[model samples]
Target: MTDDTAVQARRREIASEHLLFKLIEYVEQRHPGLLDFLEGSLDHLGDPAHDETKDDEAVRQIARQMITGARAEIAE
Candidate 1:
């Protein structure tokens, strides 16, 4: 990759790390048990018998809501 492309990728990586830290802080403060629940849900989703389209959609919606809530919290 060109130097500019490499710089842009690095910037994205840093931004992602920042967001991840913020999300962790938010979860720890506002929803302490949520991380465990998400971990369990993700493990369940990996099962072949649990691969339902409706379930995937529901998870996506829940994730979107979590992200929205986190963003709002960060803004405050």
Candidate 2:
């Protein structure tokens, strides 16, 4: 990839990670132990047998819902 493409990819990755972290923090506030559980689950990412595609999509859907709810809360 070209330098510009690589930089763009890295920027997108960072943005997604930041959004994920924010979503985790929001969930953690309401559901105390969930962040710890998610942290523990991250270790499984290195496993060859673990399939993360479905899990990742599920998380994205949930995060979108959380963002929508948070926006509504803020607008109130």
Candidate 3:
């Protein structure tokens, strides 16, 4: 991709991540179901929780999978 496309993509990613964090904060603040939802989804997908890893790799992987699945579903 060109420089412009790369920049735009990065911006999009940043915006998405920001929105996701905000949503998590909102859910956690309001219903406190956010943690349960995340853990449940990850568990259903056969992934481990935060204590399973000291690094963020597992969290990143789960986030990517969730985003990809959501995108595909939205596209349909």
Tens-place lDDT per residue, model 2, 1-76, is 5799889999998898668767866776777776456545553444233655446546655555655555454345
TM-scores for every predicted model: 0.42, 0.52, 0.51
Each prediction's RMSD over C-alphas, in Å, is 10.6, 10.6, 11.6
Report the C-alpha lDDT of model 3 over 21-64, residue by residue, as the tens digit.
Answer: 66666656667555556755653453345464554556657676
Model 2 residue 7 distance off true place after TM-score fit, in angstroms? 0.8
lDDT score, residue 36, model 2?
Answer: 50
lDDT of 2 at 62: 58
Question: Candidate 1 clashing pairs?
Answer: none
- After superposition, the stretches of candidate 1 with alpha carbons farther than 4 Å from their true spots are 41-76
* lDDT score, candidate 1: 0.63
Q: Write the per-residue lDDT of candidate 1 for residues 1-76, one digit (tens) a residue.
A: 5699889999998898668758766776776665556545653453234445446556556555665565556557
Tell me which of candidates 2 and 3 scores higher on lDDT.
3
Off by over 4 Å in 2: 47-76
Decreasing TM-score order of the candidates: 2, 3, 1
lDDT of each: 0.63, 0.62, 0.62
Candidate 3, TM-score vs. the true structure?
A: 0.51
User: How much is 27 displaced in model 3, in angstroms?
Assistant: 1.5
